[model samples]
Target: MTALLTLAVLATLLGGTLFAVALDRAYLPLLALFTRQRVETEAPDRLNRDLAPAWYLALAAIGIAVVPFAPDLALIDSPVGIVIWGSCEALIVLTVFLHGWSPNAPFPLIGAYRYAAIGLPVMLPSMFVLIAAALPAESLSLVAIVDSQREVWNVIRQPLGLPLFMVVALAMTLRGPMDYADAADIATGTSAEDSGAGRAVWQIARLAMLVSVSAIAATVFLGGPLGPVLPGPVWLWLKTGALMALTVWIGNRVARTTPSRMLTILWVVLLPLSFLHLLISGLIAL
Candidate 1:
């Protein structure tokens, strides 16, 4: 099980960066992780600046630990894996905000507030979609959730769930249209002051979160580790990798809309729709 977990973690962590590096501009940022000097802002919260990246990465690790490599096999197998993952998602919002707040700069603060505004709204749809996925399994355990999809994956069972959850994916990973925290318009947002290894670690943590979310998405909606012939871990790795690629592709392609418009859409449309998805799922399960 340890070996299985080690493989899964390595595949997830490295794939997050390696797949992204294929993008033309991404390699330099990675190279900078090693070669660049540490950047500090005026009156920065030194503690948070250092700790936020570590915390972000740790949360990503914790999120991955719950993913089952095989039946009843995981690093920290919990019955309420969905909730555990959700908790991590919630904490990330705080972490990103702190990353901005630590810099004590106007642009980063703007970025931080923007993220909070959007990220908080996005969480409702996320949990709703997750709960909708949980309906078929009648259990919150992710392994059970995966087991429930042995015959029919949730993407097919609950068609609305995956697309809605994609918003959550984009938000949690702080990428694509949802990446208000690190948007270029705001001077890379919360990371405007960050440089050197500190910035690199944060970037890597973001990618790791992206991988973590994709893996969870694979587990809930795509019948994780359920492929024929291949070992469970290998199948999981493939599914996770595919989802990672799909996520990055989508992030790169999508453009960010204005924050005010996004907020209206989230509250007026997605939140209610996701709630309906959960309601319908409950009825179907019953």
Candidate 2:
């Protein structure tokens, strides 16, 4: 089990990175459809400022590395597994902010600000979902959360929770319609100044972050490794992949939202809805 868990973590990180790299290349042809003629490929001039791509990568690596182990397969399961996972996921946002700010470029700076502006609002709602998940388990251990769903998955019990969490996950990863951080309107936004291997690392980190978050979501709501007929690890991976695909599809079909509008919706709509979900979940638990 230890070996399997370790392998799952490594595979999620490395595999997600490679998948993201390939996805970027694959999207090139499609991206051209909406791009104006004569899209610029020039690397932005670096500000006379010290930059550390390694720092960005290191932080993201640390943040995502611990998430895959949050389920039953965890090598070091603790009562606070949910808190640990949440902290790590939050670090990904800081990593992005630093990645954008470190370059000291105009577009990237604005993009980083946009990322924070939209990213922060969604976090409370996401936490509400997490709280809802933990309430039934009566413990913060992610494994406990999964075990609580043995009789029935949390998605069915708290139907609003899964979708709400997914929406926040999309925003957290800056994917799909919530991709204003790297939106085309801002010359790829926070990544505009990146080039060569530096850019590659950044892209990989983003993808890995997405994979890690999806894995957590699976564990929290989908009853990780609790499916019938399949091995635990297989079930976990299958669910993670499905969630990742759903997130990607949503991003592809939905129009990109501006940071301000996203903030408005998050505060006025998603926030209240998440609270209502929590209320419903608590009532059901009783």
Candidate 3:
């Protein structure tokens, strides 16, 4: 199961990386793998800076491991799998913050603080959304969540769930509109100091997190691997890939707002909507 999960992760990551690279950028990750150099930082937290991407990648792996490629099949099928995934989402904010803060540069610190601010609020909606998603299933298990959708998808049951969760996804992966951590304006933001092999690893870790979030999104809202004729894993792959593309596309097109404005929108608007969504989903589940 672990090997199978690893393959799935690799395949999804490859697909997402290709899709992202094909749109509006050259392939630099491979080249970075060969090059090795970085500008010196003044009194940087070497340990955290060096380990941040690895931690991010590990979180992605753990999150994706809970997603069932087929019914009852996953690297980790904990009864509270959704909760475990949620924990990963929460930890991602810290990991990304560490990525920025440990660099000990102005831009990186700013990017780290910005992401932390956005990421903290995003978690409120995510909690409500995830709970709403689990309501119909009446189980925190990802497999049971998939099973609940055998009759009808949670996308229909909880209309606001996926869109709201997308905020969490974008924040978690630092992609598209929510990409403050590596925004170009700040010289790649949190990664402003990154170069060569290190940058490559960071890029891969970001993509891996993207793939991980897309898989969880597919499972929670899109019926996971449920389908006819095709194998369960195939169904999962198709859904996950489609979602990864959608996330990247949305990220590319959505106009980014200033951090303060985004925070207002999230708290003043999206957060309340998630509460309503939870109420509605609970009623439906009842």
Candidate 4:
């Protein structure tokens, strides 16, 4: 378990690296589509941008390779299990913050602020859900949670758990309507400065990494790598891909919401939903 978790953490960090690279790549088409429209803002410096592309890609690839070690990592049975779980959430939060701050563009900066602002409320509810889900075992090790879920996914056993985690995961992963960070218009955003291969990396590889990590979260909290016939890795990949597709579809099909309105909706609607799930979980425990 210790080893597996370490691998997952590494994979998660790699996801961040890939996301940064892919973000640069994905912006090209957008730039081309809206050139000279005031939407095609120039990047800070070409040299830095060019240099970063390859470096970030290497980081992402290393991250993916690191994923397989998760199941072998330390279990959440120790006194620090809860602390470890919180750290996972923190690591993700920190990555987004870096993405926002590291860029020399207005949009990335604004996007970073938005990312941090919105993250606060959503993170609280999600943590509560994780605690409730793992409370039964009195440990925060994901391996132990999976072992407990032999008969049922945590989502099934604790109805609220899945929804709460999903809500936060959506925000953390910046999927669907919650993607205010790089919404095409608002700030011109995180992907604003990327071009050429940089844009491609952001669009494809970065999206792939996000999708993969989100899927793993689902597997850990929901029911990892589960299915009949196919092996665990295969099942995990399939489920992750499906969720990624959903996120992309929503990003494409839906109109981007203003950050203020989006945060309001998340806190007002999802917060209650997550807390209610916690209440239900407590009842189940009793």
Candidate 5:
């Protein structure tokens, strides 16, 4: 039984990794083709080559880490679970900066700067939720949190935490309309000079990574791996996919905003909300 469960988790992780690869391959090319058309007309083409491979690889790595860690990871249930999980999130953020800066293009560089600038503040709410989890479990291990939530998902008790986590995750991924950092209209976005295989990797990996991160967040804070009729892992995945759909739909619906405005919104609006959520979650823990 243990072996079978392990295999199932491994398979899910593999599927996520492949999905990331496929998405990266599919989209990077389209972006390149679009840029080519613009370049041909002497309009402007900014996609850089350096951004693709590394970005895809980074996405794949995050996919591997976030997916398997959802329902179970012995390490994440240990004393240092918080540090491990938080570091994992930080790594993903770092990869975003790397993807933005490595391109050596003006737009991508600017995008990286914006990404770094806004990333920290938004992550606070999620971080606080994780901290709150530590309070109850008396440990940082995710397994402990899951065990605690078996009786009730954290979302029920900490409603605000989920939305804050979602917003941060979406903003970090820059999907849909939240893509102010890489807003295509800006004429100075992160992926302005990539092409061919490189472009393919970046686009595919990024979308996959976004989906994977959403899934991870859902599992961690949204009562992942918990359902009465369905199996725990299956329930976790369903919730994760649902969240991804929500993010994509939301992303598509919103109009593009300027980076400065996005930053302002995060600072003035989202930050306070996130901080409030954290405070409330702390009270819930109490």
Candidate 6:
């Protein structure tokens, strides 16, 4: 199990790197047209500046590494697996904040603040969805959650839970419409100062974060590793990929919202809806 988990993590990291590279290459022609050509530039003077993005990348990798494994195969399979998942989600935010603040640039700093403002409100709905998933399982262990859904997947049982969770997952990964953190309007916002290998690492980390959240959402609501005719890991990856693709499609198709409007919708609409979903789940459990 340990070896398999290690292999999975390494594979995900490599895939994430490739995904980032592909995205960059896809946009290279447009980038070359608009991007300013640089001559000679001095290396960063501060050692901390040189190392900070790496630190951010390391945290992102650590957070993502634990996500693909089933609870039985997990390194830490506590009853509070949901809580741990939340902690891992938080690390993605920290990574963005660190990446933005490390360079001490104005736009990046503002972008980091925007990340916090948007990211924090989504947590409420996310926790409610987690609670909805836990209600049927009667255990916080993700393994137990999957087991509880042996008869009926939570998506059918608590339909609202999956959508709410997916929204929060999208927010956590800064994908889709929730991409205020590094939006193009702010000169790539939090990542404005990033270049070369550091930029590559940051991009890889973002993709890995998306993959990680998709895996968790699959586990919680889509019946992770449980499908017809396919192996557990294969089902898991397929679901994760589908969810990731959905997120990307939505991000590309939908217009980005202002921070204030996002907050209003989350608090006024989504928050109450999540609570209602939790209420329904509890009644159904009884």
Task: Compute each candidate's TM-score over C-alphas.
Answer: 0.95, 0.85, 0.93, 0.68, 0.78, 0.86
lDDT of 2: 0.73
For 1-286, candidate 2 gives per-residue lDDT tens digits of 7787667667766776556545545445334433434222345334311243454455445544444343455654678877876676576566667767767678988988898888777788888999999999998877788889889999999999988988887876778888868988999988887665556545555666667777778888888778878777678777877887777778778887678888898899999999999999999988
1-286 in candidate 5: lDDT tens per residue?
A: 5465556555555565455435334434455555442211122323423544465555445443433344565312355555665665666566667666665667777877777777766666667767776566676666677667777777787777677777766766667655645767646377675555455556666665665666667766776676778866667667766776777677767786666787788778877876777677677777
Give the distance in Å from residue 148's predicted Cα in candidate 5 to where it truly belongs: 1.4
lDDT of 5: 0.62
Cα error of candidate 4 at position 150, Å: 1.0
| C-alpha lDDT values of all predictions | 0.85, 0.73, 0.85, 0.57, 0.62, 0.73
Candidate 5 displacement at residue 154 in angstroms: 1.1
lDDT of 4 at 247: 51
Give stretches of model 3 more than 4 Å off: 1-33
Q: In terms of TM-score, how similar is model 5 to the real structure?
A: 0.78
Q: Looking at model 1, which ten-residue stretch has the lowest summed lDDT? A: 16-25
lDDT of 1 by residue, 1-286 (tens): 5786777676666765566556425777687577978977898899998898998988888888888877667777788999999899899999999999998999899999999999898999999998888888888899889889888888888888988988899999988999989888888999898888888888888888877888888888888788889988778778877887888788989999989999999999998899889888888778
- Tell me the spans in candidate 2 whose CA falls farther than 4 Å from its real position: 1-4, 19-71
Q: What are the per-residue Cα lDDT tens digits for candidate 4 across 17-41?
A: 3443343354455456444332234
Instruction: Give lDDT tens digits, candidate 3, residues 136-235.
Output: 8889999999999999899988889999988888888788888877777787789888777777788778877877898899999999999999998888
Q: Give the TM-score of candidate 6.
A: 0.86
TM-score of 2: 0.85
Model 5, residue 11: C-alpha shift (Å): 3.3
Stretches > 4 Å off in candidate 1: 2-7, 23-25
